[model samples]
Target: MNKILEASLKGEVLVIKTEGYLNKDLGQDIQDAAQEHIANGINHVLIDLEQSNIVNSIGASIIIELIEQLQETDGTLAFCNLAPIIEKTFKIMGLTKYCSCYSNENDAIEAMS
Candidate 1:
């Protein structure tokens, strides 16, 4: 099942770890979680998608929305541990132009922080 495994702050960045398919529902869940942190003045978001290997178009669009939302506050969005296909999809969707993809959580956190 699609679900957000965890949402927590790692330093000033909000880290959201997800599992299963990244469809509309899970994307919305991720947006909601990030929204809360954004409201509280957190600008950097790191999504750990090690367990989520699938993403639909709707999910990608929702992430586009999330990127816009973060931009409104001068925040940034990032991803880590993405599957090869997912990374390629994001690149094709132009997501890589806005956010970055890291090989692991530590690399992402270190870069974002």
Candidate 2:
């Protein structure tokens, strides 16, 4: 499937919602997009994955990188609308230990506040 990475500025938090497959290549795009916002003074980021179904290893790597970067700046990275499979993958990979997971984008936004 085609990869889609659309980003928006929501309040003080930068919201990036990913659709399609999140593979190694697209993963980099996700990182780049998030970085663009952080460069513009957005420390809190929320990635809404409700529309995403498949995420490869490369995507997971980039997600980890985003979490690390956010942490260094005393920022936060939250995830929402994750598929059960992807959620299991993240938990197995220990992402949940570092990043926060929400049931939906609204909850994620509220947490960002």
Candidate 3:
């Protein structure tokens, strides 16, 4: 299934909700949305992945790029509601070194704050 990406501003943070597969198109869509917010100086991000189950390499690469960009401005990107398999995949790929994972949005938001 095609991915659906939605982004919204919650005070100083940007909350991104994604569903379906995280493939090339969806990954790029996420990158663009986050980059636009970053350019505008809104840095903290919370990605809700409750509806997403799979993330291909392309999606992972885009996420890495977003992390790099956020790092440049001392910003943080947190992810929440990830499937166990996806969380393990991220850990195995070493993405956990750069980003944080949370069990839910509230935890992520509190931490980002």
Candidate 4:
């Protein structure tokens, strides 16, 4: 299930939902999905990881790259439905400083909006 489950715009925010492991491929897919929106000035992004429970270093690195990409647009990246371990890992990787993690998509959307 290394794929994007869904991608749509909610207001001005681009919400990308992913499934399976957050590996390089899936990470790239997420980046690609958001790139167009970011380019068009939809800077706020919410990644719903309710189905993605594991991530490798490369995946995390790509997310870091995405954060950099968003910064160029003065945009932000947020995550929702992160597993406890995934949230801890992002914190340890210092990713939380660049982005935010919410318990669910609604919370993330509200906060981002």
Candidate 5:
């Protein structure tokens, strides 16, 4: 299951908190919400993964897809509260080269702002 914790505006940035699994099944919804907010001119974003785990390759692909979309708009996406396994996975996949990760949501928010 995928849950959108909430969407908030912090100055010029947009923070999107996601809970639960991120898989191909939930990819579209995630993309939709992000695009909707980006359409409103909220570009910078922080995704909090504090409550989620178990992201498969498909999930990672979806996240990459979202990253591509955001990149096209010159927007940024940062991740927070990532598990060690997921963090390593992301690093191995070269995601860390493009996206930033923080120890906590507050740090992520600060990084984007």
Candidate 6:
């Protein structure tokens, strides 16, 4: 199934919740959403990936792009509730070095705060 990306603002952070597979199209959708929020001066971001278990290389690349964008503005991006396999994939791919991963939303929010 196609991925669904839902974004909302929480205080100064933009929270993005994703479901289904994260492929190129959905990755672009995520990127667009992040860019829009950044343009609006909301820099910190939290991505909840509990329901997104699969991510293609293109999607991963898009995430890297988002990280770069945030870093340029000294903003932060954190991921929470990642599936085990996806979390491992991110670690193996060294994404965790750039963006942090949390066990839950509360932890992520606290750290970002």
In model 5, which runs have C-alpha deviations exceeding 4 angstroms? none
Point out the worst 10-residue segment of candidate 1 by lDDT: 66-75
Q: How many backbone clashes does candidate 4 have?
A: 0
TM-score head-to-head 5 vs 6, winner: 6
Q: Which 10 consecutive positions of candidate 2 have the poorest summed lDDT?
A: 1-10
Q: What is the C-alpha lDDT of each candidate?
A: 0.95, 0.85, 0.86, 0.92, 0.79, 0.87
**Candidate 4, 6-53: lDDT as tens digits:** 999999889999999999999999999998888788999999999999
User: TM-score winner among the candidates?
Assistant: 1
lDDT of 1 at 112: 93
lDDT of 3 by residue, 7-39 (tens): 988878899999889888887888887888898
Off by over 4 Å in 6: none
Error of 1 at 65 (Å): 0.7
Candidate 2's C-alpha runs over 4 A off are none
For residues 14-96, write the lDDT of model 5, one tens digit per residue: 77777787767655556767887888888787777787776777877777887887888898888889989889888999889
Clash pairs (backbone) in predicted model 1: none
Measured against the true structure, the TM-scores of the candidates, in listed sequence, are 0.98, 0.93, 0.94, 0.97, 0.89, 0.93
Which tens-of-lDDT digit does each residue in 1-52 have in candidate 6?
A: 6555679887787889888888898888888888888998888999898888
User: What is the lDDT, from 0 to 100, of the residue 33 in candidate 3?
Assistant: 78
Cα displacement (Å) at residue 102, model 6: 0.8
Worst 10 residues of 4 by lDDT: 34-43
Query: Candidate 5 local accuracy as lDDT?
Result: 0.79
Report the C-alpha displacement of residue 71, candidate 2, in angstroms.
1.1
Candidate 2 has an lDDT of 0.85
lDDT of 2 by residue, 1-113 (tens): 54556699878878888778888877887888888888877899888887888888778988899899988899998889999999999999999998899998788887888
Candidate number that wins on lDDT, 1 or 3 = 1
Off by over 4 Å in 3: none
